[model samples]
Target: MPWPVAAHRSRLLLRGRILLDLRHPGAAIEELREACGILDVEEAADAVRGPALLDLARALRESGAEDGETRRALLRAQRAAGDDPELLLPCLAALAAFHDAAGEAGEADETYERAVLLAPADGALRCQLLTAWGESLLRRASTRDGAGIVDRAEYVLREALKSLPARSAQRGRLQGLVGSALAQRFRHLGFLPDLFESRHLLGQAVRAAADAAVRAEVWLQLGRVRLEGWHHAGAPVLMDALQAYESAEREAQAAHGSDPGSVTAARARHGSGAVLALMGRPGAARSAYTAAREQWQRLVGALREVDWADVELTRRVESEPATGEGRTRAERELRDREEGDWERVAPPWWPWTGEWSNWSEFDRS
Candidate 1:
């Protein structure tokens, strides 16, 4: 490839990343696909082929492409990466995240381990990989037989924090992850010591967070710990949890420039509602729940309006239409998924039916 041609492809890759960040995944997919196609045609383009495929995979994921397509892209990138740790580590991390999302815990764990072992002694990249692995563990810890997972998550996150200086930018976020993992353990065992330590670490995280969005999440986690404390202690802890939730709501709103439909804001509002109900304030709880419902409704409505079909995937499927019945079934499934995305996205705490009976037990308590 000539220098100018290589530069042009680089520019396309950069533009695709920018579009992805700006939430234009469909456009990003087009730009990245062309860049990947350019590299594919070159006889000796292995140097850039891996990165181009990786970018294309990211764009496809953001565009809601099928898991199989995304997996194939990642696998291709991995093969092209061949022995280059710089390229291979990222491919591994993305594959780990994909496997984690699909609930393939063994694959996710193995991939994360490989990436971690291949990483250099210490740096931002190593820290990031550790953090991603820890978070994945924390998520899995929410399921059955999770006590061991919590311990592993805590160990992994703490190891990442050990190399960081006090004022390092990642300190607050790592602290938050460690705290959350400990909180999960506390829930599992009703261990007051874990609860106390989690509260303390999360408080530090909130104070040290460089980003408002991160601070908001820390605040929310702090509220959860305090609420758990209340279950064991008393009313004072309940009030403290309520204050944490209020701070979370404010910080979440500030982080997104007061976007009323922010997912974090909705979560904060839902937390507030739960705290209010626990505090025997039915009217206030109802008001908070109503606000959360409205915010979630806006988000759901926006998602429903998106055109989820990937143009390339659609064309390929269309080209091989063996029977009309097959196309009709595929169409029906896509429509069903779009219609039910809200149910999949919404948290279990969300009031799906808007019935006061859903909270009657709490009210009576």
Candidate 2:
């Protein structure tokens, strides 16, 4: 390939990466898909092809596209990551997320377990993995609290938090996660400390979050904590719950003028209605509940309409192609050339059990 063409393609690909990092997945997908097209027609190495495919897969998955095309992109990336498991790890993670978005929780958990199994011993990778796992558990807890997952999430996050500097955004994120997990546990086990700590950590998360919607989510979560407190502790804290719920509503309204299909926003609206009812304002409570119900219904409708796209193209490309794998070496091949290779592949953990599957006859304690 000509230097000019390669340079142009690389530039586009880099721009796509920037867009993704900047939270513009729709634009990133368009640019990265274009870059993939350019590299696909040329004699690109797997190193080049793999990153492009992986990045594009991420863009697709982030945009909530879980169709045959997304799966194909991830599978091509899996093949490209054949020699370097580290490269393959992210593909698996993204695939798991895709499954989660598609409402296939069983498959999603299994895929994530595979990623955990293949996770490199690198600290950053492990931290990211824990973050992903915790987030997954939190998402799954929408139906039922995964007490085991929450316990493990808090443990893992504690370790990860120690590595991050005080007051950093990453640290703040971990704090928020731990708080969320604790709140789930509090509901299941009635731990007062968990409820109180949850409120504190959620407050910190709201302060640290740069995105308005995220901050709104934190406040909504805090509102839940207060409500839970009232339910478990009695009427003394009913006013506290009402205040928190109103705060949640104020934050959510400022974040999105309309409901915006956010589960957090819906819950906030509902919380406001419940709080008003508790405060003896039936008319106002009815209005709040009606608004909340309409928003909740809209969210359900949008979720049901989600569809996968471009399947035949994806499936056919794999069957017709004979892809080369000459440049599929791991990134560590270059980075750790002098530092010596890591020879150990640690055992994978079981999400349901919160234990390592590779360890035999080991005590859980």
Candidate 3:
């Protein structure tokens, strides 16, 4: 006999409850696998199953499952569920985020563009999508297009903030994201004025963040802005920026735990190392670079291994040149070579007056 309607509904609801309880990331992924197994066994064409399946796919994506599997599951569920636009939006957003994580910039951009089109009135989602879109553009821009992307980023961020309620908790996070975007814009333009604004906004974000990890990110960005403008400061300012980055790193590490897959901690280490290198402290800079490099290398390796297929993300971590020591050696060699040549031809250019023979000897002295 066909299953009773109420009994089928109860079974589906029970399965959903089981999935919801699978909250730990690892367990959630396993639950998704189990859900797939259950669906396969049922093999029944029931419209009611679509929403539950979509939820399962979303849970899998958020839990850090491979993108291909998540996309396939979401697409199947979405199609079976009659492609409801509202239902599709979350899956689209999740897919876009997955592609972004995987470094598939073109795919991510396209997905987010479609998502924004679907939800035109969602100011916050639009802003987040636009910021991400602008980031991809900035990465790929030749010198000609980078500035325009930055401008778009700034406009979108402002618009998003304008749409938000004044007391929204998301305001702080949005401000931090905008500040980071502005700092990138300034860095590309080599303009100091924008950086001042960036620093101010980042300071506000730092004060407003309730989460330790988010606060660390704000402080790290602030340190980066200060370090970039370090030429304006003496040793004291440089030291202060270094301290800020170091503190940020510690806090991020504490909040995320060691090996936390934390982009913030990795970035903080890199920023700290760069500032140390600029301050002429090679040993400390090398140590920081080593940590940053390790994190970046792991991420890159993960990407290369065809893991994290849902999102396409790329990161470039730079370290102080190992050839820095060689610079001193090269300089000494050049000076010795010049001295040898001079010794051989000293007569006419005696006392180093050859290049300035027209000047009076007293003036030369």
Candidate 1 TM-score, true structure as reference: 0.73
Cα lDDT of model 2 by residue, 56-154, tens digit? 877786687757777898788778778687577676777776776677877877887787678655545555655665566665553354655667656
Model 1, span 195-293: residue lDDT tens? 899889998988888987788888888887877675565423567887887887788788875543466666677677666655545467567766766
The collision pairs in model 2 are: none
Q: Of models 2 and 3, which has the larger TM-score?
A: 2
Scored by Cα lDDT, where does model 1 land?
0.69
- What are the C-alpha RMSDs, in order, of all predicted structures? 16.0, 20.1, 17.1
Off by over 4 Å in 2: 1-43, 59-66, 104-107, 110-126, 145-149, 153-163, 191-193, 203-211, 258-263, 290-365
What would the TM-score be for candidate 2 when compared with the true structure? Answer: 0.64
Give the per-residue lDDT of model 3 (tens digit) for 232-262. 3322366777877887788787777755345
* Best prediction by lDDT: 1
- What lDDT score is found at residue 45 in candidate 2? 76
